[model samples]
Target: MGRHSPAPAPSAAASAAAAAAASSASTPPPRGGRAPRDADADSPSAAELRGLLEDGDGGAAPGGGRELSYLQAVNFAGGLLLPLRLPSAHAIHKRPSAAYLEAGTLLGEEAGRLLKLAGPLFIEGITNIGAQLVATTTVSRLGAGPLALSALVLAQTQLNFGYSIVCGIAAAMETCAGQAFGARHYALLGLILQCAMALCLLFAVPTAALWASGAMAPLLVRLGQLPDVAAAAGSLLQLMWPVLPLLVVSETTGQYLLAQGVAAPASVAGLTSLACAVPAYWWLVGRLGWLRGAPAAQVSLQAIAAVVVVAWRSARDARVARTEPHRATWRGWSFEALRGLPTYARYAVPAAAMLCAEWWIWEAVVFLAGLLPSRAEVQLGALGFVMQVSIATWTLSYSIGTGAATRIANALGAGHASNARRIFVLACCLLAVANSAVAATLWCLRHRLSAALTPDPEIGAEVRRILPAAILGVVGDGQVAVLGGLLRAAGRQSTGALIHFCTYWLFGLPAGVLLGFVFEWGALGLWMGVASATALQAVALHAWVALGLDWQREVRRSAATVGALLGSTGATPTPAAAPARSFAIAGLEEDGLTEEEEDGDEEGGGGGAGAGAGSALTSPAGAGGGSGLTSPLLGGRG
Candidate 1:
């Protein structure tokens, strides 16, 4: 209600839609000697009869808007339902085995880093802000019935946090699928999909169970300990289930595109959903006045039309992608797809948990805020705005992080350590420069920004007080962002996940609450927690990057844990472990072979993972690769 991060700027689909309109022939040629009647075609005869119907409506009533041409119509339709179209198109265009893993690896690495640091922090801000908005708007507009709104916000917050994990899993799927495509392991892609499906199915149960176990209102009341809050949360949670499948589909589709270097649809989906959902929310609850119980029902019913159009188009596209079904290799549900399940699940589950941990950190902060005075409500709202602003900008970090992850993984898998190092340097430089700019802007705007959110001077004051610390968190947030993406990309997701859990949950949230409420620092204290946690995570993420992830351990754990699941589900058994090859951080130890031998081996059957690690004292490639090293390298102090 009060606003958060300007709803992330109209998304790729919206932009495309607008572009199609502007570029295409705005008007249609005469049809029936006047205009084409396309919008209400019942059938072929019915279509012909449409002329009669139009005539019945008094002289062909000039077809409201010009009918779009085939291309224009397709583009327009795509924009209208871009989320389903773009993602589905990607899956169709690149079958699992046909994708490029190196590219995916690069993207995944970057994505992992961005996700680890910035991603979670970004969402925390979003959910916190969302809670604040619901609180503030409800108080502003419907003081008497604000409790229902609060409940809705709490429920929404939980669902919102939960949805981020769905996004992560989707990314994991996209990354692996992309990699398998590159490696020409077509079956691997199927395996990844199979495992992802199994994992998604597996995850849905636990997450749903957790939602149910929370007892909805009681959980909210206990966390916030507010009676009105509890009631609102319960009602909201009850309605949340219907949205789960939608969330999963949306996230998976978006991630699939990211793997293919397509950002528009995912971005568009986010923008469209926020823009559409927010207003739709007002219409269902505020205008229609369905406050007594289950706002989700009203929401689900309203969304049906949009869903139908999108789904119908998606189904059609999927069908079109496969002209003829492959012979049933093994009957009912191809067990062969199960081959990659263990591998994907191994990476995905922790990746999902890592994502969940990051989200929970902010959720904890909001929980802490609930314990404070109602004035804290305004503070939380203000925090949300700051966070959204940060995240919208953070998208750039996600792009870079995804790139790094893909590059690092690809180089490593292909045995190119130097390239991986160079890529890492590039990511840090880009992220740092971008973060600095955001910080400067925040500093300049802090004063004027707070007053805009509310009429109350007290709320404004609290926001300004917390603004500096919050901005500091934003900077640290960027570092963590790339680091997390890099880790996931490099197959070091567990390390990143551990760092997140420790920093946010173990340290940050608690510290913020204690300082804010216990010490009477108020909103500023809450932000202090954010700064502290982010700083801690930034240090750890960088450290892990400097000292590479224990891939051996990761691979082993992934294999062991995922193996059983895959076996039970009829997926392939684990492949034999390769001989461990170790190198210093710079990827130095060569396997000693002639150039011809190297080339031959590279193309031969004796394939292996990425280059050995070591710091290369080699000159930077065009100097872009080493743009941000401030201190002296090789152990010298600046």
Candidate 2:
């Protein structure tokens, strides 16, 4: 291989001209004076990428293979389970030396952006989980015996699934919001979020009725829960009504803020409220009664914090709108926004299914573990303890995953397909790094951490016994958590959902039962089976994505998705040919040639919120993450 001189990088002007040239060549002009919607079918970036891959610049040892090898996936899995010692999927392995330099630079940029977003996400997850820990501990102290403790644990575990389901429904906003923000179609971001909020609230009515009214555990009772445990748990759940709607609100709103790369206030609010809830737990439960509305206040604060952050950002955005004419706010969108609900649901339903199905797989393990004969009681306790620890560590992965999806969406929206691909691999690297640390730490402190998670020495000992399985399981959990998000960004939510169903529901669960009950390995065996399934799931997903997924195609798909969403409700700008074909239409204002020209009326000011009255929003350094009624997400577990 003679090292002839490297190809010089194209300038900004040359890049734009190449893109315009490629767009013209790839797609034809629309008919009858219509605007072009698919003009960028083969964008300049995409065309260049195709050529690069052909020359074997696809990160496979420069001239080796174009795609990520099976070996890379194995290394990635190993890295996650084992940490820095193993290699993770990386673009550097695919490109030539000059390309390698560019790939490495992009990897760092993506990593930094990912950490920026994931940091708050982890904080939110911690605080949210911490709040639940506080509430659970308080309930366990009720002096109502081990039965009371058991009931609350069971009740919460069930509620966690419900919470995940609703948030799953809201996850649609991540894709819509991420793409819209990236393409600078700022108004669509607000509209998509509003639609998500409305949709989630509709789902929440039944959820609130069940959780707030204390009906969740009763549903479990009818399914075969012990009457006493069900009754006690239902009573605990009954006091949680105030948190239901707030949960959906905080989640949907946070999704909106994160897409715009704003995270600090919500993070601060969630972490602060959760931190406060710890002390509040002692005072509220000790004096105000058990399962009382005291902890709900923290949940409420978290929800309020989420709203406050959005509002704050909205207002700042509004002010910017007043000055920056390029920030195009759509005028008179109530009718359009209202009509888009069904359109939004089209995306949201599957998005929700993907997230919920995976989360419930964990819940299913708990339910099945209860079938064990004499050891069912302590076994459930041991399982729940380890599962929560795994879930808690998953916060980091979830945050990173969310950031990965958002950043991938943004790059794709901007028509940077190559960057999107680079970032995706980098995200996997980051995920492997984070999960490796989790595996290493859990492995190191099994004795101490296990004892700390429970009061009963026997249960603690059981936790230690199964700690290795939990450590291994989280390696996969963390991988899928991020991969799942990227899949959504790639317009493959259904595929991700299907993969998860097969992995956890069809395969993992069956393996667990076979190993646990049939093989008599008990809880440890069940966990080992599940852990194996997680690894398989991650490997399978990595393999499928590496071989089949195309970043350039995904970029085009994202554009079509947002364009179609906009057109469905007559929200597409007049003379939409350029927008339909061009990734960044170069112009959005009606009369002005550029975005800096202000609209005649202030009513059209804040473009990010669409036709709704402008809400204040701004980008700030975020401080944290959150999940369920007792979730460990945004403020505290709402």
Candidate 3:
């Protein structure tokens, strides 16, 4: 009766218009601006992210304020809201006390992750240093005079450059493998590992020729070395020819293993080989070309140990070897791997440059010390002693950064941008804390350091004079070194390389020359230059990461980078061959097995995370994209 009296029934068109108005009214507008486009809305602010995570469903109320189940929420909320950029610890703590507490706990998780990643690396690093120490001490026992010692240092510097090149190239495997695991591109991880090894073998040829022909020594002579010293250096380098390929193989295999998540074995291999180095040195010290053979044997032992461990570990894990028929990417040795060389060079070249720039700056300083008065041998020997000691301790902080990079890369590949930021923050904080403790310990021992390194009072005195500043420089470099790892993880190797070029090459080296020589400040002056460069570099990297790093963009870029390599390496399976994200190729599914299967394949085969287990192979990119990491200077820290 009321309806008949109110008015004639509304027309269909009027009813439709009224219904539209009611629907629009049901959903409120955002408090400020219009809703962002899909791409823009994909990465939301922290508060918006909180909304998406806090509810029982752990999802946002899309359509302004409507909650839905997880599946429907995607349509309602227009996909997950990810916080990409990690401003800094200061900014995160400044938000509120509650957030600060949460941030602190998150930071702890970050630290824990970094430790898990870096602990093996740290042990590996120490083992490596121990090997070097043993070799050097053995050489000293052979009664090489200061001239021979000087020659050895120069040879070591040149050989280190070659090592960097090979390690640099192998590092591409880290990026591709990590992303492949994350994107569920398991076959691609194997292909990348193989391709990288092939490239290293090829590159070693030219490196061998250069070392054998004495080309590396002329540069030392030009740098003001005595002619006799240069010749001795050339002889030492010539003896090291057998080691280049060995080093490349070891590094490539280890990197491959680590990306797959088998970290403990790599550490074990490193330690076992390190322990054997002394015996190798003793056995070979009396042989012809013994100067070269000792180190060759030592590194060869290490390389063989790493590769063998990976093989044995993979065999032990049944799930990892379920499908051995498809192990080879192309059935044999193929240069198709060479297709990825240029792409790798983009990352490796910069990384090599960065490490070389930092390393050579110091080496160059050592040579300049020769230009000083009549104490050239004493000064050069003293400088070498300091550098070796510094290297032994410097790796502590670098391991932290390396772990951070690995975790960040794995997170990005898994499409978790927040986890990546958490890793970045944790890395920075861990480096600060770790380096602080290391710096303090080193500083406290400054007086005894020189006496321990060299026997000569004059040389010891020179090292003593410079030890304080040199240790301090270690702290500063530690900060920059780890941040450099972050850039590598983010696939911004060029940025890190550029910073190194500017700070170490252009500014730091030149300043070191002017100060140490022209100003007569000596070794102390050189370290001061390094300190200055480290400060600038740390500031630059920190600013870039905190203010300019667009992690969402990096996520896309990383995916593209890894995808390009997978395609080039011929690892992508055909559409009809299997499901896109299926674990068929790595043998995750085989022989009528039920859905339940052992996790050996998922942990898979590799070095860094317990022979390749990080749950990295989670989901396919789904026509989407990610990045992973193998550090340029990180592993190839010559």
- Kindly state the number of residue pairs that clash in model 1: 49
Consecutive 10-residue window with the lowest summed lDDT within model 2: 620-629
Q: After superposition, how far is residue 279 of candidate 2 from its true place, in Å?
A: 3.8
- Give one digit per residue, the lDDT tens place, for model 3 in 11-55: 333344335445654666679634222122223345544443344
> How high is the CA lDDT of each candidate model?
0.47, 0.60, 0.58
Query: Candidate 1 lDDT, tens digit per residue, 240-333?
Result: 6655555554445434333322233433333344444445555555654444324543345325523533453354335424642321111234
TM-score of candidate 3 relative to the true fold: 0.73
For model 3 the local lDDT of residue 550 reads 60
* Candidate 3 local lDDT, residue 518: 83
The true-versus-predicted C-alpha distance at residue 304 of model 1, in Å, is 7.9
Query: How high is the lDDT of residue 20 in model 2?
Result: 57
Runs of candidate 1 with Cα error greater than 4 angstroms are 1-144, 168-171, 205-215, 218-224, 286-288, 292-341, 372-396, 406-417, 517-519, 549-638
